[model samples]
Target: MTARDEILGRVRKGVGKGDFAQRKIDAQAWLTARTRGPQPALAGDLLERFRNKAESLSSTVEAVADRGAVPAAVARYLAAQNLGTEVVMTPDVAALNWIAHGVRGTARAAADADRVGVTACFCAVAETGTLMLLSAPDSPATVSLLPETHIALVDASRVVATMEDAFALLRAERGEIPRAINFVSGPSRTGDIEQTIVLGAHGPCRVHLILIGTSS
Candidate 1:
């Protein structure tokens, strides 16, 4: 037997299994019957709320009119920050016309030496200003983690109300979950050093978001 079978056999023997398939059904029923607990009234414009919360978490947000303007926006942000025009991107965003805008986008994994990474998030959470990324062949986890500067190009329509909404959307859309789901809230930071907060301690120090589907 494989390692999985071996471990599961031991579990079954220990637990004295009796209709484990029914248990699965019962678990699904329980999940379906579950209701959300009390949460804050997230009233008003979702985009405004998301932008405010993202900025509060140290993430810079920029709104563009449409997807066609994304490459130019990326170029502008890099130029302003003095970060080079060369950025690594996920395969989903690699097909963009980066060359026309004088920016080079490499569809590959990012390294520590890589300065900026351009990625499109699966969705952006308005509640906590978190970015939900479902990892796939086209969307690797390293592209967003290793780089010093992370530039996310997200559609404004994909911004959800809460963390629960994000997960609900995931379940409704993707049948089989991706292997890795990354939720990025601004840039990586830590406060372990003498109770003082430090940014870029573990990941990208700068997170610049290009929010599409809105007026600039």
Candidate 2:
């Protein structure tokens, strides 16, 4: 047999005595009963806390009254930054009227030439101001990774209190975890050179978060 098959065979022989179905159920129960360790008590609303923490991590934050205002806000941000109007966005946010607000958004993987990219996070964590993104056919990771500027649209309702809470929501909503789960705190930075910090050393130079409170 092949090396991979041989290794698998040996592993199975060692632990294949019990009922796999029962083991799976037991493992699931254990996961459900898992408890989180001590966490820092954070006050204030989740959205505000998330915004404040994100800003501390060097991410710019803005809040919108509703989802319909997103495109205009994006345009305003681009204008303020003097960035190109053309953007690569995830399909999830493609419903926004980008063209009406003097922006062009293409739903696809970001190319090397793409300067701005827009995306929507699966969920956000208030404890660390971290964003969680699950990879899918419509939500390619590249849209958030390869651009000079990355803008994420977050729904206030999806904000979780902590990392553990975020994972719990993930497990509850998506029974099977995706192949890629990305957690981003802010812009890509590196302090590896003589302890001098540099932005965009490995990825996007800037990260902007737009929190949507309501869709109506």
Candidate 3:
């Protein structure tokens, strides 16, 4: 017998040989099963808990009436921060009339010079105040990673109580995982330098979230 086959035979014999194919099939079935484990208790209003947790992480949150109101809110934020009005956004949100609000919007991946990036999130985790973004053709990952400032638009109805709920939503909606899944809790920070906290060490220094279809 071939060396590989001989080794496998020896292992099977020592372990009391059984149906290898059936074992593989059973393992696959178990993986595909929608089995849930014990989760922590998360109470109270999900949206309110999400807002409080996000604010605690130093992320600015705003409530907008609908998708059409996003541009004006973005413009206001930029103006308030004395930042430029030009932003690179993912194709999913590029259809909004950003120019009418005195902000220029480019629907493409972010370039090094792009200071701000705007994209729509797949969901938000209320437990940790995290925004979950799935990367796809319409939702380029570069728009959120390469910019100095990241602005996310989350639908209020899409907020979930925990991370497990977010994953379940992903499986129910997308069926399979995307190329990349980003969970952004807040602006990037690092405390590795002499134990001193430093923001914007690896990613955006500022993160802003606009909750659509919610009252302020």
Q: After superposing candidate 1 on the true structure, give the runs of residues whose Cα lies further than 4 Å from its correct spot.
A: 1-26
User: For candidate 2, which ten residues in a row score worst on lDDT?
Assistant: 13-22
lDDT of each: 0.91, 0.92, 0.92
All candidates: CA RMSD in angstroms? Answer: 4.1, 3.6, 3.3
Give the range where candidate 3 is weakest over 10 consecutive residues by summed lDDT.
Answer: 13-22
Model 1, residue 79: C-alpha shift (Å): 0.6
lDDT of 1 by residue, 130-166 (tens): 8999899888899999999999988999999999898
* Cα lDDT of model 2 by residue, 52-74, tens digit: 89999999988888899999999
Q: Work out the TM-score per prediction.
A: 0.89, 0.89, 0.89
- Score candidate 3 by TM-score against the native: 0.89
| TM-score between candidate 1 and the true structure | 0.89
Flag regions of model 2 displaced more than 4 Å.
1-12, 15-26, 214-216
Residues 1-216, candidate 3: write the lDDT tens digits.
899999999899776566878777776688778577888788888999999999999899999989889999999999988788889999999889898999999899888999999999999999999999999999999999889899999999999998989998998999888999999999999999899988789999999999999867
Clashing residue pairs in candidate 3 are none
